[model samples]
Target: MDTYLMNERPSYTAYRERFLAAVQRHQGRVSHYEHPLKGRDGETLYTDVAEIGNPDATKWLIIISGTHGVEGYYGSMCQTLYLQGLDLHSLDADTGLLFIHLINPWGTSWLRRVNEDNVDLNRNFIDFTRPLQHNDEYDNIASVFNREAIEPEQRRINEQLWHDRAAEIGETSLRSQITAGQHQDPEGIFYAGQFATWSNQTLRTIFANLPKSCKQAICMDLHTGAGDFGHPMLMAITDHDYPGLEAAKKLFGPWLYTVHTAMGNTSDTGVSASVDGYTSQMLINAMHDKDFMQLVIECGTYSPSMLEHSLRFEHLHYLEGNDPGGHQEPGHSLKSALLEHFFPHDQQWREIAWVRTRQIFDQALVYLRDGQTHY
Candidate 1:
């Protein structure tokens, strides 16, 4: 099978088929689960999760892709390439591998950040008994969307309003409001649904059905569109002082940057609310005997302002149903920009990405094999 590189950006259908095919090639050595969904294209889109090695292995590495729909193109491609190139015979007897690909198939096919219902899967995983939370800050900015036509003057006013809100509430708080997840507005950006989405329910099933034989667990959830362009930033999601954080730092060495809960340069406040609704948190919460480590490999694709503008345009296009072409024209441009930012089309970038990914995976494998809790 041909291996895909960072420079290669396959169409949604082509990538999905290639990924499925790669899993099929390893059928004897790996088990597969398909979480299928009906996409806007009127086709059955599927999220494929594959497992390798013995079910009873004491150490397991779980790598997931596509929590943010469009980001999956790079994440899924990376995993598929890794799996195709991996040599199963070299793995230790006590270590296992789990690759969850395309968590949001709807977003992927439609080139959206959210699912079909416009629910951001990252923010959908909150505990229900505590009463759901809504970002009222967005309500203040709701006028940005009430317009039939957004003139250049209106856009300037909206930008000022957003900046003023950030200044008033603080950038971190504003970021939390925009990203912490909310159930109130289905059409709004970063909307967390009032209930479990199809992906949410399907992920729960996957977690519940996880093999009983595994012991320790490490997860790397792939993402993009945050940080420096083309730089892959590894962010640890657990508490800053967690044993896993230290171990990960040791394992990945100086190349891996740690984003702690309180001390890191990166924003960590809104993440807990974001992941609380996803499968990773549920899996970590359920595992009593295993030491769980979770990392989010977020590759930078564009400037923050660029990303915000693109996302804003995407939401506007979705809400107004204003498309010059048959499909969402602005959304497509944003998607293209996002893809280029994370997975550059340049051969030099592809080479560097390939090398970095290989090193990370190798280090992870070594850590699992040694059964070293410290690493």
Candidate 2:
């Protein structure tokens, strides 16, 4: 694979097959979980899992990609690079590896943050029968994202509204409210959804099938578009502490930042603490019988201001895309801007992201294969 792929358009088939080929090189036991929806270009999509090492191993280190759709470019490439350099023999016989490639196929295919139903897969993990999370602040400003286009005046207005909200409730706190995830708006940005999304269900199913022998597992869900430029934050994100908190602290040391999630929490980690429903939390729930460390590696790009504008623009473009009368697809610049926000074009950015990711994974493999936990 090339170092990076940046554009408004990315071939989901291309990434899927490349990752699949890499998985094949490892001679891992591969299985495909076909997605229900086809790609925007009619491509067959799947979440492919390749299991290496014995199922009855002492630990399983699972790395996942594509939880945020377009963010898959970064994660998928990182997976490929890791496999290319992986000497399977270096892994202890008592440890196994599971590579889950692209859990949200539809989102990746469509270059979107949310899945097929406009559901943010990360936020789609909650039990449907219980009371869902509501963000009234996002509701108040939801209309800002309900625009026909991302024009100069509109940008000014939205920026002003953002400043007002920040003034009223601190910038980071307001950001947590805006992005904390909401279930009320299906068409608006960051919709958590009313029920389990397809990606959510499929991921749970895949987890159930993984080898039950390993009492220790650490899962890293790959993501981009948050934090300082080119800096990948190693995060332990959850509603509360899990079985592996101590192990995680030991594994990553000061590199690890834990955020406790609730309705009114705040964090400078670039991940929302004002919300529930996270990929890490779901995996922690699924593997509760085991000592598990659920971590997220969020690679950063662009300033928060740039991210804000692109996100709203992309949302507008997505809405226009489905109109009966039809709307022009956003120009290359707009598309490229969105992509750059998540997956940058700079060589330094790509190199830095991969290096940090590799370092994290290296430490994790050691943790899974040899690092012991008192818990």
Candidate 3:
């Protein structure tokens, strides 16, 4: 199938075509589940799940991509390339594979992190039984997201305020307050949806339809815009014990890092608060009766400041619209720079990304098929 043909990095439209084409080519063994888009475009973005091996296989390797929309470019590419070259005929009677592509198509098309509703899908999976939780800390920072221009004084004030809060409430508290999922302000950052989003509902449906024959499931959700440049870090999101963490570290060696508590070097205070309804959590909640494990593979692109600047400008451009002049203006450039920062065009970075992803996938497959944890 020349999987590399699926490797050509293209714009949103081209990527969609290549993905659909790949599914068509493998339609004999794969079933496509189409979700009609609710937006005005009337375009239906497909989330294709490909199953191979026995229907009743006890062990399943589930690879999912594009939970964050913009991050799907790398994730979709990995899944497509894998399927393009995968030999379905070589089946392990006890094992199965499920490939879920583009969980959030709107974000992918618009190249944004959130869905059409500005909901961070990762933060959208909360228990509705509770009074819709709000990140009060985020409320204090609402001015940071104000549509006004980023004045030099405002930037200085923000920096000083951040440090002051870090000292007073602690960094973890601050991070938890901000990043912890909130439902009050839909327009604000990391806003967990008031209700299940389309993607959220779709994912629940997908989990329900998972083959009953599968006793164990392994999931890897691809993400970028974190960690070191070009280096893919396999991060653990589950609150599982040391054994599960050790098993993963042993399987992937130094390539993996465990983030059980929000206290490590990579730990930020509000991260836990903002990540209330992560896909990982949803999977765990759905598969409580089954043995399930998952990993979030985050590839770093830019520094904290750069990422913040990029996201801020992108948000500004979307909310304020482009200047009358053109994309060459500062606002447009900021958005462009953010995209490039996360999705670097450099050959070396791309090659490294592909190689590392393949390594992780191959290693995960071996772990799944063997049914043995080696540390």
Which candidate gets the maximum TM-score versus the true structure?
2
lDDT for position 14 in model 3: 66
What TM-score fits each model? 0.84, 0.91, 0.83
Model 1: residue 268 alpha-carbon error in angstroms: 8.6
Residue 43, candidate 3: Cα error in Å is 4.0
Score residue 369 of candidate 2 by CA lDDT.
63
Model 3 agreement with the true structure over 80-101: per-residue lDDT tens digits: 6666666666546687878787
Clashes of 3: 11
- Weakest 10 consecutive residues of candidate 2 by summed lDDT: 323-332
Models ranked on TM-score: 2, 1, 3
Off by over 4 Å in 3: 1-9, 24-42, 89-91, 148-176, 240-250, 261-274, 306-308, 321-335, 373-375
Q: How do these models rank on lDDT, best leading?
A: 2, 3, 1
lDDT of 2 by residue, 76-186 (tens): 888888887789888889888899998998888777778889888988888888887677888666656655224557656766666777778877666678788888877
TM-score of the candidate numbered 2? 0.91
What's the true lDDT of residue 354 in model 2? 90
Q: Model 1 over residues 1-375: C-alpha lDDT tens digits?
A: 354544456556777777777777666244434445565556677777777777688788888777888778777777778778878788788888788888887787777778877888877766766787656776866555434225546766777676777778777666655665567767677777887888887777776767788768888888877766657776666433566667777766766665433212236422433333554455556564468777777776666552265666666666666651115555567566555654557766555555566567777888787755333
lDDT winner: 2
